[model samples]
Target: MPPRDPSALVAEMSRAEKLSLVRGTADPAERATGYLPGIERLDVPPLRLVDGPLGVRAEGERATAFPATLATAAAFDPALAREQGAAMGREAVAHDQHVLLAPGVNVVRVPHCGRNFEYLSEDPVLSGTVGAALVDGIQSEDVIATVKHYVANNQETSRTQVSAAVDERALREVYLPPFRAAVAAGVGSVMTAYNRVNGTYMSDHADLVGGVLKDEWGFDGYVVSDWYGLATTVGAATAGLDLEMPGVPAPGAEDHEGEWPDGIPDAGHAGLFGDPLAAAIDDGRVPSERLDEMARRVLGQMARIGLLDGRERTGELDSQRHRDLAERVAGRGTVLLENDGVLPLADDADVALLGPHVHEAKLGGGGSSETTPFHSVAPDEGLRARADGTVTTARGVPPVPSRSLFDRLPYLDWGRDDEESDRPEPSLDDAVDAAADADVAVVLVRDATTEAEDRDSLALPGRQDELVRAVAAANDRTVVVLRTGGPVETPWRDDVAAVVEQWYPGQADGDALAAVCYGDRDPGGRLPVTFAPADTYPASDARQFPGVDGTAHYDEGVFVGYRHFDAAGLDPTYPFGHGHSYADFAYGGVTADGTDRVTVPVENTSDRPGREVVQAYVEPPTVEGVDRPDRVFAGASPVELAAGERREVTVSLDDLAVRRYDPDGGWTVDAGTYGIAVGRSARDDRASVAVDR
Candidate 1:
């Protein structure tokens, strides 16, 4: 039989049943991150929501752990991103989950944003395109994919209280594109951010949610507020928020990231969405039809996923295929930021592995994105397996402390922080000695970031900076590997022989590192976010960042990431899309068709296989009264080439490249000549073409 109509089911549901569908309830299995129970009499199954972007994060369950979304974004390969999404979807379904809270499309506005690792990119076109692919991949598995943190949720500091003062055009052009793309791709759900936009809580914002998203964009999915992110009952209900998560009030009501208060087990339930919503509807504070709409949306998603028909969903976990894919992504996403002929180390040479937790796999950053893999490979172990010569190890500094209050909590700590607590003390002298004695010294350092908090600075935490200097001084051939969630200031970049950016490459971290270091895999990753000093970004001011009083101002408009760098004429530590390869790729010639398409011929000049990301930037026409960036990232295509192979890469310009957001006219195309630059990075332009529109 076909899926039942959601309208009919909503008509049958009473007020109580409708309210139940609108709020989360207790999960009997206690495995899901969130749970929503439908009407039992109508046989509507409860939706099991799991925290998944990196992997399926069902409590106490093991799944295939993939790299950070930032890592995937670095690859600039949507095919890989979609594959990861499908793999995660299957894993969630294996654990009987219905909704996957994933594909966080929020633009990386702040380098210090603790949750930057969870997002895609600073450029909207890249983030939006990749995010939509993830949504398509997840929904293809018949699971509801949630595109989240709604709008302008850039910082983690005071996320629950601080308001992001974004203008209307900024929202349309900079922050809202990714969410819009996800919606356009037919994503099943939208998650509101825990923060506020322009002093109005997103959960209760009618103009954006109800008018812009639902009315203008025609998003036909349910709008669920983030856990404990709801503001008001009637306001949210009337504002087009279809669901409130966790059903009850959390343990620490004020602290969005805090644990359950004192004695509360699992999660608390104060029933804010339960009785309060019903009361509002009964007393006419909220329209009765709004409740019906909520129930219909929930049922609609269930029907779409085949849950209403009691379809059996089975998926593989810890499969060899998934394991290999994990390693493949980690390898492909490895960005070589700098090098001086010291990489792809000699297989027979003695190597010194020096860093904190060389024995532990740097899986990922903390909070909801964490996943417990069946097994993990440490860098030391992986290097030992791959290298033909002796591999000595020494800790360069004390282990970086995971500064999350939630890290100590039982249910939330899925990545096994307890196992890491009793680590042995490190000695700097031993590290220096090891470096001096070895043919090459590999120093691994990482910055700690987690949810519910923002990093104090872009500087590496603890004594790692000191450690890098010491090791570099001891051995001239010091190869520094940064296993961070996002960009960090490399104050000692010039001192090192080479620098590798392996952004939190999940469970296969060790294997990926070994392969890349030993020349088995080429550095295929590129900088997704620009590397800059702590104070160089558009929001360098205290008032613009963590905010003053109550609001954080977004005064820079559309100038974010490389756009900011270009407009301000400031050079970053490393430009966006900058990366190195063992093989060199030469661009022959580039031509554009005045509008939609740009064609470039590229060849691998070196005798090694390589992957090249062909990037195209568009310079919009000069409108007399309008102001725009120096250039906007249009689109890119990743090319795979064998040695001595020549191929033509076609990069289709994004429709939004020449468009400007007009408050009165919506997105409009300026009638003038447009310039398109084709290059490997934001700053390096290989060729240029003009378009008259």
Candidate 2:
């Protein structure tokens, strides 16, 4: 039988049934986080939504914890991202979930953004490509994939109240592309952010949601507001916000300041979607046809995901196969930032694993992306399994405290704060002694950041910085393994023998780090965002970051991440796309096809196997009146090679990459002489080719 027509179902639904389809149940606990009951007479099933950028974030449920989206973004491989998304989707189905609220494609406008780990990258092209892949993978599993935090939801501070002051051109070129890609990938849902875009709230923004997204982009999916994110009834309904998420905040939920208001649990009946919406329709504040459109969109997504056809939950959730996939994806994104002959430690070499995180597994950040993994591998246990010599360990510092108020909540805790009572906490002196006695010191450092608050600074949070510096002083062959969600300033960067950026490597954190350090796996990951000194970032000023008076102005325009550094001619600690492998790769040359494609030959120059990410950046010719970045990332290709293996990879610079966003003309591909630089990183240009468009 053919799929059900959403219009026919909407026409059959009465006013009460249609309103219920748009808003969740009046009781929050009874309904899934983002859910709306179906009309019983019409056999419409309730939509059950769950959070899952990393994994299925179902409370009290054990699931596979995959690496952070930024970690996978470092791989620069869409295929791997798709597989990871499929794994998450499989587990979502196993958990009986319908819509997976994930694949946050918001551009990492600032490193200090609290939720940067949940996003893909600073460049729109990379974020869009990776986001589309995840959407495709999730939809393939007969599940609805929600690409979230629509528009410039770059920061967490004042997220609910602040306005992101982004201009038209920047929105078109830098911020909107990823969501556009997700729509193009056939995503079933698009989630609005908590903040306002310009002066209007995104949930009720007419130009953004209705004009740009629905009209221009031709998106057929429904627009769901963030949890407790809906601000109005008629305005949002008319502006194209199809569903109000968690229409009622869950019972016992407190406001941002940690205060629970009186009679909040029963407050859902009076809000945007229940009685208020029905009243609006009766008074002609909103047309009855608009309500029909909203119901049609929601039912259409359910029909598309096969929910209307009785798709069952049968996929495996926490098996060893899923764990193996997590390990593989984790290892691929472990970036070897700096190495000076100390990495790939010999199996027989005595090692000292010193840090608070040596035994504890900081799998991921705090909040909705959090997951309860079946099991987690700690660093010492993984090294003990791989190293054939004595491996001593010491805790250099105490674990950082959870600063976010949500971390203390039961639902958001996700079993991450539980302590292993049997392990003894070691001190800084013990770590220094262990470093002096061992052949090499492996210092495990972690920066624990959570949602709802931007990091106070980029420096390592606690006494870990002192511990690292002391350990390096004790042993010249000290290696610093940073397990963080995103970039951090390294004051002792030059002093350490090596630095490995293992960005929240999920459940396989220990084993993956062990594999990279012991030569079993190459550190194939690259930096998805730029690593610069705290003061060098574009939003370093007080007026720009966190914002003043609830407004964040995008003063730098299109120059974000490496683009800022390139335009200012300033050097970052490590440029974007920077990473190290056991083997070296040589770029033969770059040739353009004169159209929208370029091919580059890369060869492994060492005896060891390696992976290379060939990055292509376009240097636009100077236009008299227009301003552009020094160079923009056009596209990239990732290649794996055996010793002495070579391959010529072709990269296509689609219109999104090659063209510039015009305020009046839209996306325009101008006729000009373009310089394409093919290199390992944004700063390392190995070869260049000229082409005319």
lDDT of 2 by residue, 405-519 (tens): 3544533333544464456765889999999999999998887776777787898888989999999999999999988878998999889999999998999988998999998
In order of listing, the candidates' clash counts read: 3, 0
Model 1 worst lDDT run, 10 consecutive residues = 261-270
Model 1 residue 234 CA deviation (Å) reads 0.7
Residue-level lDDT of model 1, residues 1-693, one tens digit each, is: 567899998888778888888888778898998898666798887888999788998988988889888998898888888888888888888888989999899999989988898898999999998899899888888899999989899988878767999888889998999999999999999999878899998989999899998999999899998886788887788889998887765445435434443212233434567888888977999888888888888888999889888777777678888898899889888999989999989999899999987888888887788888997899999999999999999986888876553654544433544545676778999999999999999999998888767888889989999999999999999999999888899989999999999999889988999999998889899888999997889889988998899889998888899889988899998999899888898997788876788999999999988888999999988888788998988999999899989999999887877788988888899898889999989988888888788
Task: Give the alpha-carbon lDDT of every model.
Answer: 0.87, 0.85
Per-model TM-score versus the true fold: 0.96, 0.96
Please report the TM-score between candidate 1 and the true structure.
0.96
